[model samples]
Target: MNPRRKKRLLFASVLIGGVAAIASLLLFALNSNLDLFFTPTEVVQGREETGLMPEVGQRIRVGGMVVEGSVDRDPNSLKIAFDIADSGPAITVLYDGMLPDLFREGQGIVAQGTLIEPHVLEASEVLAKHDENYMPPEIAEAMGESHNKMEYSKGSY
Candidate 1:
């Protein structure tokens, strides 16, 4: 090969390699920081399409209706535990902070936390629905069909 052509080729190769390296790094960063959403049923039985269960210690958001009579409070402290379900098996969530004012039994909520067990989550934050008619889109979609039959409240559907 001519010396000039070889020099140009080497420069081009280095540039392309650098670009690829940067792109791969960015993708890795995004994947690691992502917080996947799941329902209580999905956590216990795995997702419907992917059939993949979340790994322990992975950060995630779980949305569902707070199981009636599942809220247990520590009277002495802010710690509390509750079960959430979506027309299927329920998962218990543990939190150590004040809950949202709107939070209550039979209400829709999304809890952000890390999975500590197959059916347990160590929640860092819990958000309740703003109103009676509002349900998170993800939860609404996940609970379709079965949600209509499993009444969380009387005359509310």
Candidate 2:
């Protein structure tokens, strides 16, 4: 207890345990590379004010609207599948490749990947909407109030 104050309390407890092991390994590598961004009615009715669903296989990022006819392609190739919606319930997704040319259906997209259930989603990157008053502020805050009446009739309020 007195060898130079036990070597300054063992170098201040090894520099506070190496800054608490690098802040818990940088919060477990940012929570294992978090994606999380659900919508399709918060992935089948969950996150309306923290009901917080998403957890089949995790890695989310859905967004919405694309459910018009629920595009389902697969002419023996670039796979597909659809259904996205936000006004409530609809998820599906799937995907395999080549889809952004302003996609289709009711428009508005996002995708990303993994969730595999609780309403599907397997996409590995879909992203559409590259024009017509761009909307992706987390799908206009999860399409609330129908994106404020389509940004007040496109005057973009």
In order of appearance, the predictions have TM-scores of: 0.91, 0.39
Model 2 vs. true fold: TM:
0.39
Top TM-score prediction, candidate number: 1
Residue-wise C-alpha lDDT for candidate 2, range 50-119, written one tens digit per residue: 7888879888888887866779898999998888887777878888889888787777888989987888
Taking the tens digit of each residue's C-alpha lDDT, what string does model 1 give over 18-50? Answer: 999999999999999899999999999998798
Error of 2 at 66 (Å): 7.2
Q: Where does model 2 exceed 4 Å of error?
A: 13-15, 26-30, 40-59, 63-68, 81-83, 88-94, 97-122, 125-157
Model 2, residue 84: C-alpha shift (Å): 0.6
lDDT of 1: 0.91
Task: Provide the overall lDDT of each model, using Cα atoms, as 2-decimal numbers.
Answer: 0.91, 0.82
| Model 2 residue 124 CA deviation in Å | 4.0
Q: Give the runs in model 1 whose Cα sits over 4 Å from its true position.
A: 145-157
CA shift of 120, model 2, Å: 16
